[model samples]
Target: MRAIGKRLWMATLAAVLALAAAGCGSPASNGAGQGDANSGEPIVIKFSHVTTPDSPKGQAAEKFKELAEQKTNGRVKVEVFPSGQLYGDKEELEALQAGNVQMIAPSVTKLVGLNPAFQIVDMPFLFNSREAVLKFWDGELGQKLMKSLEPHGILGLAMWENGFKQFTNSKRPLKRPEDFKGLKFRTQAGKVLEAQFKALGAGAATIPFNETYVALQQGTVDGQENTFNNIDTQRYAEVQKYLTVSNHGRLDYVVLVNKSFWEGLPEDIRKALEEALKEATEFERQLAYELDQKSFENLKKAGMEVYELTEEDKEAFRKALEPVYAEFADVIGKEFIDGARALK
Candidate 1:
């Protein structure tokens, strides 16, 4: 636990330093240059995300790349960087803020530090199903939340789906609220998740997503939670033995672009990019649903003991964390929670 804490702290510190350095460069050095949309010179957009090239976000990114370039008659070129090649989850946002990268699709919870409202999506068991999630992102609440990012130098283009989070551990099958007691779980760097684990009498630590597989394999943490796609694509099933379909949380990303870069784009090119993003986002959401179902089956085939709880069992877990709603209400707003609950 101490070692994991030390590593996490060091990683956080390094990210802060990188962000500080990012701001040192002039606006011209930040990649805010807007090549003429109608000119022969290609407009280059560097898209960075932290996931496998074959993952939903990766595929959608490629889709956007293909469509954007094709739609513009090769006037726009999107260079895709996947699996943290350009920057890890923590660094990518700072990179985006500094215009080091023109775009990124990081987890929505990753923005909690910028605006606590971003943590609204991380509220445990917030959405009953993917349908509800889609509605939330496409409705007024979604637009309101996206609008919140303007102050932070990011343009929230859309909410891209990952999937529901399921609990996994190597120690034992986690079927009840008590099952989480004393367990150490890896969570994203956010307060809501920390509180969620604490509510269950478990210890939670924030670790970089890319480091979670090894952390679980080496017993740095007893368990972790993630979408089926993340667990399967990252091969976490090999290290963890138990899979509890808690459906306790959702993992989604905010497709973002540097405000400066996006604003500088010619109107026609911006319109084209927005159109491409709309299609790509829908494709990603549909594929996310399919991949999520498929990943669960794949995990079982890979020798995982997967378990799903009854409604009563789910209720027990939900009841245990009920306090989290009020605890975060001030930050996320009671109205937003009420609105979301109305959807369910």
Candidate 2:
């Protein structure tokens, strides 16, 4: 644990003990999963996320909550903290690694910080379509990436969705390469994004996802980029006026639990949770897709300027980002980059 986090934990436990002494809720086993439940105790879990309640990840989490309750016969409870209420991606990830938090849904792009090998998933324009993105992650490479987290004391559940990302701003429509110049943009706290934006001539800063809506609203940035689902659901459209269909970045949101928590669960509960996550992932993906398309229309209805790029319009972006491929060659490696391009 980080030095401050350790102190906070000690303080929190002390406060909780004081509360219990005053006849508050009871404390059970120190371990995470079924161990506490099997003894007729309710195991309440904190599930953290950075997206709004309407994003694919949020829907999946809600479904997981329903299924978990039914499967555990109300023995397990999942309390969701969306919009970074529990912690931001990197911090929540670290907390989960230390078992300070039970679960989180950080962008795969963020995981690259822990293991550079995961950067392969963040190469812009690498995924031709959402179909391709799904295939690659469900195949060998994705499972291999999951194993990467095991060593850090986190366990991977199925991925929900990050709808393909687009650009939105207040300064101007992103019609050409020069239009994006001198623009200050917000990106998720990922090195890959810094390179991606820098390649496009934008001044980019890594910011926590929770702060983005307010940042866009308050004019702290000229523009920011995200999926349609995020902008519409988080009400980013209420603050910003332009939407550009960049489709340049595809995202994957993974569910991770404390490794010890998952391992200690009963086999039956584990299987049910796995089944629930998969079912919810697919359902949320469909809902996000419907919303992603409808958000453009919704934004239009709400008096926003929206632009869908022609191939020529996208050509400029593709060309501008070409250098990013080479710039990250060492981090992601040419072989893996090529493998992704060849995915079809």
Which candidate leads the pack in TM-score? 1
User: What is the lDDT, from 0 to 100, of the residue 147 in candidate 1?
Assistant: 86
Clashes of 1: 0
Off by over 4 Å in 2: 1-30, 33-38, 41-45, 50-55, 72-90, 207-220, 234-241
Error of 1 at 322 (Å): 1.6
lDDT of 2: 0.77
Candidate 1 lDDT, 175-236, residue by residue in tens = 89998999999998778889999999999988887799899988999999998988998999
lDDT of 2 by residue, 254-330 (tens): 77889888887668777777777777778877887887888868878877788887879777777888888778888
Superposed by TM-score, candidate 1 places the C-alpha of residue 31 at a distance from the truth, in angstroms, of 4.9
* lDDT (C-alpha) at residue 338 in model 2: 70
| Predicted structure 2, TM vs. truth | 0.79
Off by over 4 Å in 1: 1-34
Mind sharing the TM-score for model 1? 0.85
Q: Report the Cα lDDT for residue 332, model 1.
A: 94
